[model samples]
Target: MRFFLSVSCFILTFAAAAAAPVIEPPLPMEKAFRMEARRDGPDIALRWQLEDGYYLYREYLSATGDDGKPVEMSTPPGVIKDDPGFGSTEVYYGTATATLVAPTAGMLKVTYQGCQDGGLCYPPTTVDIDPATLAQAMDPAADGPVSPARPQSQAAFPLVSKAAAEPVDGPGIRISDQSANGVVGSLLDRGGVLFLIAGFLGLGVLLAFTPCVFPMYPILAATLSREGESLSAGRGFALSLTYVLSLAAAFSLFGVVAAWWGQSFQVALQSTTATLVVAAIFMALALSSFGLFELQLPSFLRNRVAPARGSGGSLASSAALGFSSALVIGPCVTAPLAGALLYIAQTGDVVLGATALFALGVGKGIPLILMGTFGSGPLPRAGQWMERVRQVFGFLFLATAVWLADGLLPAGTGLLLWSVLAITFAVFIGAFDQMRPEAGGAARLAKSAGLLAGLYGVLLAIGAFSGATDPLKPLAPIAAARSDTTTAKKIIKDSFQSAASAAELSSLLKADANGAPSLVYFTADWCVTCRVIERSVLSDATVANALEGVRLISVDLSKITEANRSLMKELQVIGPPTMLFLDAGNNEVQASRLVGDITTQAVAASAASLKESL
Candidate 1:
């Protein structure tokens, strides 16, 4: 009986095992694109090991900088795939290699992107190459494991995995014909008018949460602050409707033009002159918030604000501001906008494009509608408290101005301005004044806040002269002096501390490598992201260790000049926080060029690559 029962149990176990679901592991992300780097004479070559079913999007695959500047990268003709958003798209499958002549040396990086046959797509991935090592064959085993569990043959100078590339503003960014194309074309073809409107409206709603849409907030907020007391919900909505319509009209029209021109309107808006003008507008508003001056618009604009009173800036101005803000302040090429633009681009149908953009604008304006209608109900009825709030907005405006000025202004001057602003604010809060014990709670609170601000301001002021660009690291020179962890720490002490003027930097760069490790880091005060890289990794211990004995030179492009500007153009470095590595021969180690923001690990890896070159 026992033997029979055991035999029956074995049979039941077998039945259960056979019945179990065979869950195939989802498509392997790593297997989607296996990348490797190799030498092609003095040039560098990259081979991507693509999975059987996966493919790499060719448009996003680009090579930049010296040795690795991709000269001819050909992708095997891909199966033509029709995408709902991008229309007819060509995507490559299987393994492919791109070869380019190595420039005389600097940072050589290859950035590429891929997608699985099923659906999921990878963002652009980057690989930094060491030009010196490219001459010699790379051992796949020496490539080492990317992590303990995963080994990547192309993972040596991996900074692409540093931080997920700041999410490409919205999903509308599609690769088509080697250019940024959007999904709207396909969506429009499939859905017709009603569906497109609803879709764009949803896209507009999603866009409101993005970084580009934020600047328009203060403009609307300040504009609406006056009418909150007297305007009824109906009047509020009516005015808001006008503003939304105007904004929609302008945004859609602009999108159409931008599409026709084959340029991103958002990029144009970021031009130095444009940003400065916007910053100036914000400054004016900030001053107004302080009651320094009131904006006196034309009678046409003033009459609309207080229709009955006819004394204030008219609602027409608000609408006009909305129109301009819709075009200028919010210039992100989101999925909705992209779709609309793509549709317009392919078919010269202005009506469809305008309607799509207008719908998106209406969606973006929903928050303003709510604010105009219900926002005033919670406010203290036009009292002293409102004045305080206005002041707070003024301070916020100042902060925004500073943020905008970054990358545009000189780093040292910008820091000085910040320190001055903090100190001035502290003084206004009565930090320097002695308060009696009998002081009210509000006064005491103000004093406490003032004192804290004052302390920070003092430190910033000291940092101005101490060769410290970072406010957080005001006393960093002292800490760096005391640090023992990284070679970068010592390099910072020995060489990087000396400030080179715009004139001197050209000659410094031309200086032959002193048979020791060296680098030239291009930076400006305005590049906020670069500051993050500098504080977190450039000064860290592991990187410092790697950079030990490396001569660190800096070229401040904050004050743009013919020499520095030409230098940047020649180097193909568009903006700040770009790191260029040099060997004992003083030639640029192209594979190790770190452009924009980089992670600490990449910096250490870069140092190791540089040391290896030596």
Candidate 2:
């Protein structure tokens, strides 16, 4: 009876679990949405309203007229696509505005969907507006003036007669199009340029605790507390702040240069150089933490420290020192910093870039400043224990460096280099620690010298290897290039392939004469989330079966090639596992585009939506 009861309870629990509703976070609502077209200006501004936990994918817009065909909208001459601000919330949300050159006043249609926290999905909605109506609405003295005191139906969503203008071949604007003009859009409209400014600041604050900046906290705190006088706290605080500001300034400058360089370079940086650089920086930091070498001044350079000796080490001096320290420390947090930089670079807006950098620095600097002001009571005391702490940090840095270097190296070479470095670091640090005396100044100095030698040896080896003929070099380029080519070929072939091949495999579905509504998912093996979707949803029997009616194509972007790279550019695909849907005519359908995480439901819905469009 007891066993029977146990089995019954298990069954009940399973049933309850299956029956439980899936609670998801609220979909980001448009905070603000507005359309601005000045008679004097050459372009129309379609601004968005992005709310927390929601974002609009910028690439797949309604490029066609209501006939469901892709059409090019006039954008301001010389205007570049702006990087949509992916804000800093756990689920970031923000507004984006695009300036399009329009030949005549017509309804601009925007469509979007919302995902609720409870796993409930909102179908795509469109917001449509005639430019003429917007122009009239903007003017208080227009022929048909509506009072602000009137109801929203009268003030905001006014009725318009279709007979006033002949239907043109231009894009059909729908009232339901909410691409940019949603609740969040309104906020952005009200905030104007200031919203972007605030966003940068917010991003900066969040960057402080990232792996890049976190390690510096203890070091900065230790440096500040080393000043043997209580009066030095203010100086230390000032210096820390200054140092942070300098880093911000430097990053801002970088942002300007990067932005000018454009997105292609940014992609290259993210994919290749940036990853390697960040990994190297982390490895170096880890080694330093392990007491591999002390970054200190030489006797000649010691003269510079003399200024820091007396009360002359005022707040200004401290700030200068802090700024100097930042130059070295900034690279450590390059990953997150690079993200912000990339955003700024993509946006090509210097003010916005500067603001973002400033915000990041401020966030990173806060803890250091507070630690300096409050003293090192928050940190572990400087003692034998501190040595252990430093060693741990060194290992961390070493690991980070190895991780980064792996990106630049071929698979075998990267693995070899990482292994060698890891082992070398471990042996050197262990030997030095064993040789050191328990509590003597001379012993400490000797240990420091050993660390220097070890660091020098490691760097020398790296330099030699970097310059020497690498067996991996030839293979690396070929492998990378081949990868790109493979991806491109797959994309092009799958896009143009005979749907008859797919139809031959199944009888329930027929490829329309034009083609069936299909979704092409560009993915990669290296992408973490791509594997997840493939395993969880793409491989599911139900999903696979559902895909029968609609066509599905998967392109592997794991390999690199010029063609693949070009396709990526053409599609404006930023990251892996991007979904693009097309109609039977092989024309693009602006329904739902998802990047990163893929779910069975999303695929199903996308298929359903495309089917309806057909």
Candidate 3:
């Protein structure tokens, strides 16, 4: 009876098991995550589709070419998550694509890893693609990196960056198309060899006309004119060549060092003491040109020092002057120069960057070379005309000295010096003296110029007495307003608070909670461009109105102390004239950052944009 019960029970259990449903196994890893690759012109495009309950690790996804060299790639931002296996990491769900610069001509290889939700992690998988296959699969629609979906909050997505490399921290806010430096940098990275050469050289030619380069001309002219009748066209060409080469060398060496080391070496040379030293050099040169003294070695050491005057003193002096001028005098950072510096800083490519800078110097020197060669040809060879020419260059040297020292001098001293110079020039040209009836056309022209100089000098003197600072706008302070209460515009005082360090700046930024935007201006007393922007853009009526509700902060790098250096490094400030726009949350509105030159319209527009974003 018991045996019969057992058999019946076993049969019943078997029948119950046969009736139960079954569970299916998970799908293969390949089926869970699918990848596609294609050629997008000179670049490679990659796309991955993740099935539901599946995600790919961003750090695990990488690509390389047949040459076994890793291809440079840029991907969209991914979702941040804390994983049990990997701690905090970035991962992608749904679908996404990555863009890579095409590597050496060969097969493309891609590798990635994925994991199932609440389940096992898959091992890394590699996919090899033939170059021919990729070429045949070229997509006409995909020209660049596809824009990924981003958060709607302005504070979350400050700006979309199109840089080749992904931003490691925040959005990679850089000088863009609106900046000439950015354009040049872009060309350096993507343009053809011939195109880059022509473009940078042309840019150098254009920069030659700027105010920064004006002082160099007078220095070179004085050197050649001092050589007088003995200078041959070839000799003049040789001296000019030496000067230009030295200048180019200085720029290249200093620029590369600055970019590599992340410090403004040229800017450091603009300190008050340094400027005074350079001014003293110019003054000595001017006195020599004025026939006040000679620039010769002492008699005791002359024979031992140099054998030939032309080969030793002239060429040596030219070289020394060129190098010094490049360092201290022409410290302006134009677009092309900034571009080359940017490239060097980004790539750490001293060789190519130095070469480009050298080419730029050569382009700027073309006019100087021509002038040096032909300047002596027009001279009268040791006569009153030659003496007059020498005297003119002496005045120019004196003017250059004054300009250099202006920034370091007391307020209004520059205007006084200029007034004295103009008056002296008028006297030298016989402005008030009686002229003979037989005087020629040239004499009348000189008298006319002298009269104008005398009149301008008188104006400058009056303005100086009235405590004016700007030589260009001498009488601005003294000029009566149309109506003080009715027509006078509101004066905007310096509203910027100083930030001594990065920590202090951060605290200040966070302390304000009112939702008003903030403007952080990076400026330096030694920076000429900074002064101009402060005078023109920041002080504009429209800009001031736009920034009415904004908190203003200034960080002065003029002294370059350790604290300032740390602040600049943390802020990623390459040089002055850099403005940072911040929203109420203290997050940088990356798109609104300004580098190099700025205009009133741009400043106002940036402020408005920051406010709107907030």
Candidate 4:
């Protein structure tokens, strides 16, 4: 009985140990700092050891004004230089070192904030170090003239209690970093390449069903059927292949141009001028669908349509036409095209861009090619049903035009434009419905309506181009652009504190001050998530209001020199947009280490929580 009990106890103990959760030491404050002063060169080097997933804001400085008041660093000079060959992810965890020419070094001060992945943030920390010691440690050949070590400060780095720190403005907290090496490298890896290809193929398939391509289906079907019984099956197949190849070529060319021009051109295409152009094209296509104007080949072009003795010329022409059509339809196929364009922009290699676009075109054309091979036997015979189908397609084209037009105009004007277009369509349809077959009056009326529609589209296009009217502008004003100087002033005045390094931040914790707690946001424009937060949450009035009683300071990370990189390391800031909260006396408190989802309630909750902590 005793042996059995002992075995049971041992088994239980083993199970308990296995089931226990593992705990890790707190991530080493995301940053480390080193300061070195050179006696011979009068150079001071500040090196920062940044942890993984956090980045230091380098452009903005935390400085004390002449009157010993905290001055927010809104703008700073210089650009943060990064090593290009370094992998982005590795760089995110790497160190940055900045060297400054010192007049006479006493102690170099550094201050920074860092964010963690788990959503908690550390208060701003500062460190002041002896540069001579750093210089000595870094030198390999020095044998003499060692600098004496300075006495360490008796006053410990201040630690503001969690209870004393002011509440942050949002429901959750965020840390922002701008180093892109990791993200870029991950995107360029083999797995990433495969993922991108797969995504492009999927989008190409989807584009086939869009208004941009759907209208071409009937025309393509009719043209294929017209090839007649004399044409061999092989010839028919060749023509179909030629057409698809043409489309691929055209798309490839477009992709090349997009890659060369990069983001700026893409942005322009999405802007007003491009929107208007798309609207015009859609309107023209809609008119053509309604049979108001036939989009036919010129009579002189009939020679080219003659039966070819060989497949080469016919196939090449078909391919060329396909290519041209691809270019014409490019702007209309925004979503899929945008993805391909982005891929091209990122790679900057024309071959990759062309290949991606060609893949997309093939995906788009495969169905049409298969349909052509089987001939019109697969389609319903042209009869009353065909007429009805044509009408449905016409309505679809009209709908597309209206949608495109909406993109060009402001909401109010865009709605008006759509309403007018719809009413005109209804009138023309009703007039045609009432007319007798012998009476040409219906045709004339329909022609008049088409003319009117064209004119209306032209006017709308002009308006969109001139910015005299915007159809898609939201009714509510965007909060980010609201320029209430009083609010801005109040927010700035509340969060005042002297700038210090990670070590100094530790020292400040011991000193107490009287005021509402303040939160400092260090970020850069290059950080993707930082832009997202600014566009989505920071623009919210409620979030901005929550920041009212608290001090909010934004540090720009783009300008941090090599010297500051060491300070960034000491602060453990791996990336941009690191948020740190401090009490009235500028001591560190609570911090939200990660940027959460952009939402009003979420941000409000973050603000409320930070306020409560204060």
Candidate 5:
């Protein structure tokens, strides 16, 4: 009787603690997901010591800069679990280790996601540490056994993932969730290699126009644009070739890694300090563009970094810069790339992933290659215009850095800093000053541009003072109204109901809605695309009007947990902004399942499909 009473009292206390709205002390990052490494002859021995009660998602295990390149290094098979959130996903509990066959002198960018027994799941995180640093972190047992390698099981990692492997009672085309993303993924699933390659290559060409690819351009343009002699077509060809090859290699490697390991670069390190490092590097490069300091390395550092001032030096520099840019800039996923990545994640096939990425890289580099070839014949003759041109690029780089840093910093801080940078940039561009009456067309244009910049800068400053976070919305008057709001729209928020746990989501999916259909919206803090949808499409009143009576289940993936992760897997959703629809009978309404960002009209049309009047 005494023992039974003691157990019952312990259970009561646990239940009470679970019921309370209390925040538990978080584990130190190092202890929670500690990364350690050691040298085993030419090989590198790496281990992640997960604290007790914390589990690592095997699919999230990632390796970067292994084998002297950003290759998609593999991990041993993990213990399988029928997760409540993501059914039949593999996970590693307590401790896990992997080996790199031939380690190189480069940054070891590791990414992994884990959850505690408390039900909190961390967003995918990345750690870029030197091999030496990792070695120091986990000193190998002086008498420890060398890490012996093991082969991965083919059955365990079949081409098609078991989560989606099971046949569902849905339309054949419903495999992928969104339009472009879903369509391309469906084609790949149908096994058309030529279609996949041709489509992704075209998509790559399109992605080149996006902001993510901008960082690589200035570096290459600056390199090719020397004052003394025009870059000969032959040299330009060689340089562009080297740059393209290196970039393709890096991106292809990244695709393979993402396929094999299931982590996108953005998902891996979004809002992390490593992203800040990339911003800092670009800031330093911007200083060089301003002629603050020569980019050429010191004599002693030259040998260590790259060859000095010759054809070989130029080629080496081009290749290194290209590879480095691909690794750093990390092109944001567009529809085509997202489709390719989706295919890779579901299949874990590095070969197809690498090929698609290679094609995409080639397409992205086409403009760079063509411009370098034909645009080199301009005669600037090393005058004032040249310096001005360099300064223009300098300001561009600074602006880009500020833009990249925006996600990491708080909204107010980002706008304030961006405004200050804009002011500085304007000063260089001749803002707050009139041009000489006899100045050239270009000079007059510069002054005109600077005048506009100055006006915008002042507006930004005012917006900052008034506590407006969005740089685009630089008005003090609307600040209070905006500050009082939350989510896409007040009415939309009311329409959407939050599902915090797997049980809740399962119930929502299973619950009978009489005759109404339900739409499940997936979102997370790190998902920028989700924000875009909210700001651009979902905010439209017509779109919201169409969803008047349909059930809206909003799943907050930011609060990561075992149950949540499993639910995402069950939904076959790789990341955020997934819209899953279910009919009254709890069957997934495959016809209207949208992935990523959809247009306002597209959403309205879908809603129109749902209305009884239709």
Candidate 6:
């Protein structure tokens, strides 16, 4: 009886195991991603409808005509995804469309690839298209469901793997296209991992002189003065180090986010509200420096605050200020920065990228740290000179406030504010006062500087009243009649048509009927580097002559709107001071691209190179 029962149990277990369902293999690549080609107005549209639980890679999508020449295709922004295999990349779910310009009414070839939600990736699929039949292949007016695509034989169209599609040297960016940022990236690729930190540190020190990092000096000085008599070299270094560490952390965090998501975190912080808040903070600090109401924590919190090393109220405030300043102040996209971001984005190696970025911050802070160390030196710590120095910092803080608020003000309002500041400075220095014969050398020097300041203030007032927008070129309009170069500058400046939206940019590009090569300049009013480049490079007569017939379009991104973000994404522009060179057909010549402040010679060279390419 026991043997019979055991045998019955064994048979039942075997039956249950045999009855279990088997997992079915995934569908073929062509069936998973259905493709349909049709003529949609003047453009040939290719749509890929993905199966449930499947998505396509935007980077894999490409089209070419019968002449075997690459065709211009526009695709909507895709969802950013971090795939274990592909790193940080953009993908499309549900439906994806590639709109291509009609290429001489010939046959077209489309290639694409996709992967299942948690399964295998499909091999690259190619679809052949005949332009004549595309019109009848699908109805233009109907919104009905698309019919299943006819599967082409695997033998007729060869499958290309992802590895084969990308260049062997890099994933997406070509090695030959060595823009400034690209050169930095190549350095990263070639340099030993251990040496990368030192290299980035040196690069950061070099970038410290750029407009992006210059604003921090005044801010640091103002913060350090708050310590007054108590500020020794040790305390100063400690405070500066805390601020620098916080800044480095903030930069690393932003760099990682931008690389992983391909979104400008700094741009998000440039909203009107953020700008106003920053301005208000600066104004409050300036007032405090001028002996106004003191800023202090409530008594209850002050007593309870931890006294840990670098954890006092002042140090905490310094850390917070450093982090916030990094977010709101400098949004400049320099070569080393862009290269680090690109490396992270392409390789998804946040650790190495972040290390390099931290080293860069340290390098940039070297000078600031030294300044902080000597912030209170030589002179008696409790003299009237200390108060006077404090007042000077107050003026600097006020100037910074004006600069921050300048972008939001109306035309010439910034110049008005600057004029007021200059006049106030002149008054503070006793510019108009009579001098005695026994005056010291220092007093005479101060008066001389004051006189110059007063004169400039008067000039600024005149220019502001005359409707001049540029502080650097306050009398440009008045001088335009006499100087042919100024007149040429005005014409060249006016030649650039502004595009606030992606649609407007497309319209501008399309309206270039003469098929002239174009230069698309990405700019923002708050971008100090952009202003420098505009004044020094774009306005030059030599550079203007070089780009005489090129279509010039400026995309204003001062508002931080969705349209502006879309334009940035479409053009792959990291930030302002970026200039993209386009061919006669409006196709971007990536090799001739420029980012950050550039020289007139560079612009002329790029323009010449672009025309030669055409």
Whose TM-score is greatest here? Answer: 6
Q: What TM-score does prediction 2 earn?
A: 0.43
lDDT of 4 by residue, 1-614 (tens): 44336537744753553344421212335222221223324444344455554444453224332344443332222234343322232122244434444434354454554434322234456554444454322333344432233211111111221111232321222222311112222333434444444555666676677555664565455344334444455555566666775776677676667545532222323445555665565566556556687444554554555344322234435554576556334544243454345444433334444656766776777777776666645443445544444454666656655654554444346546654664565555553255556867756676566666655555554444444333333222332246554443222222434333333333334333555565656554333335445655676677778767765655455445443344343343333444555555554444333331235565566567667766
TM-score of each: 0.49, 0.43, 0.64, 0.39, 0.64, 0.68
Question: After TM-score superposition, what is the CA distance of residue 183 in candidate 1 from its true location, in Å?
Answer: 3.5
Q: Estimate, for each residue in 1-614, the C-alpha lDDT of model 6 and write its tens digit.
A: 44336537744753553344421224445556777666555666667767788899999998888888888888879999998779999999987867778776777788888887655566566777767655423332345322333222222212222112222221111212454235335554555444566788888888777766776787777667666567788778767766776787787777777667765544645567777887888788778867887665555555554243221236667777788667643466776776676556544456667767777777887788887777646523656776777677778878878877887898899999999998888888878899999999999999998888888888888889888878877886677656765245422446789988677777777775777778888788777677777767777788888888888988877666777776665455667777888887666665678877678888888899888879
Clashes by residue pair, model 3: none
Report the Cα lDDT for candidate 4.
Answer: 0.46
lDDT of each: 0.61, 0.46, 0.69, 0.46, 0.62, 0.69
Of candidates 5 and 1, the better by lDDT: 5
Question: Can you write out model 2's per-residue Cα lDDT over 1-614, one digit (the tens) per residue?
Answer: 44336537744753554355423223323222222222213434454445444444444334333455444543212212233342222221344434444446455565544333223233344655455544423334443433333311223222332213433321121212222122223323455334533554565566666554655565454445434343455555554555555555555554445444543223433455556555655555455555566444454544555455542233333444455434333433232344344344332334434554555566667676677666644444457665665665565556545544543554356445644554465455453666534567766665665565465445444533444222223234344545845322111223323212222212212335544666657665444346456646775655665556556665555554554554443344444566666666544555455554567898777666667778
Residues forming the 10-long window of minimal summed lDDT in candidate 6? 166-175
Residue 53 of model 3: what lDDT? 80
Model 3 lDDT tens row, 1-614: 44336537744753453343321222345567766665555666667778788888888878887767888888878999787778888999987567778765776767888776654466577877654555323223444332333211222211221211232433222322333234335554455334455677677787776677787887787677666677778768767877877887787787887777767644656768778888898888778878898776555565644455532346656777788778653467665676677656644446556767766876787778887787657644567876787777878888888888887778888899999989988998889999999999999999999999998998999989888877777787777433365432322326788787766676676675665567888888767777778766766678878888888988887777777676665555667767888777666774677766677888888898888887
Deviation of model 5 at 465, angstroms:
2.7
Model 3, poorest ten-residue lDDT window? 151-160
Candidate 1 per-residue lDDT over residues 443-499, each given as its tens digit = 898989989998888888888767667767777776777899854342342347333
Q: After superposition, how far is residue 450 of candidate 3 from its true place, in Å?
A: 1.9
For residue 117, what is the lDDT in candidate 6? 68
The list of candidate 1 runs beyond 4 A from truth reads 1-181, 185-195, 231-245, 300-307, 331-350, 433-443, 468-481, 487-614
Candidate 6: pairs in clash:
none
Task: Give the TM-score (vs. native) of candidate 1.
Answer: 0.49
**Deviation in Å, model 2, residue 258 alpha carbon:** 2.1
Q: What is the C-alpha RMSD of each candidate to the true structure, in Å?
A: 18.5, 17.9, 23.1, 18.3, 20.4, 15.2
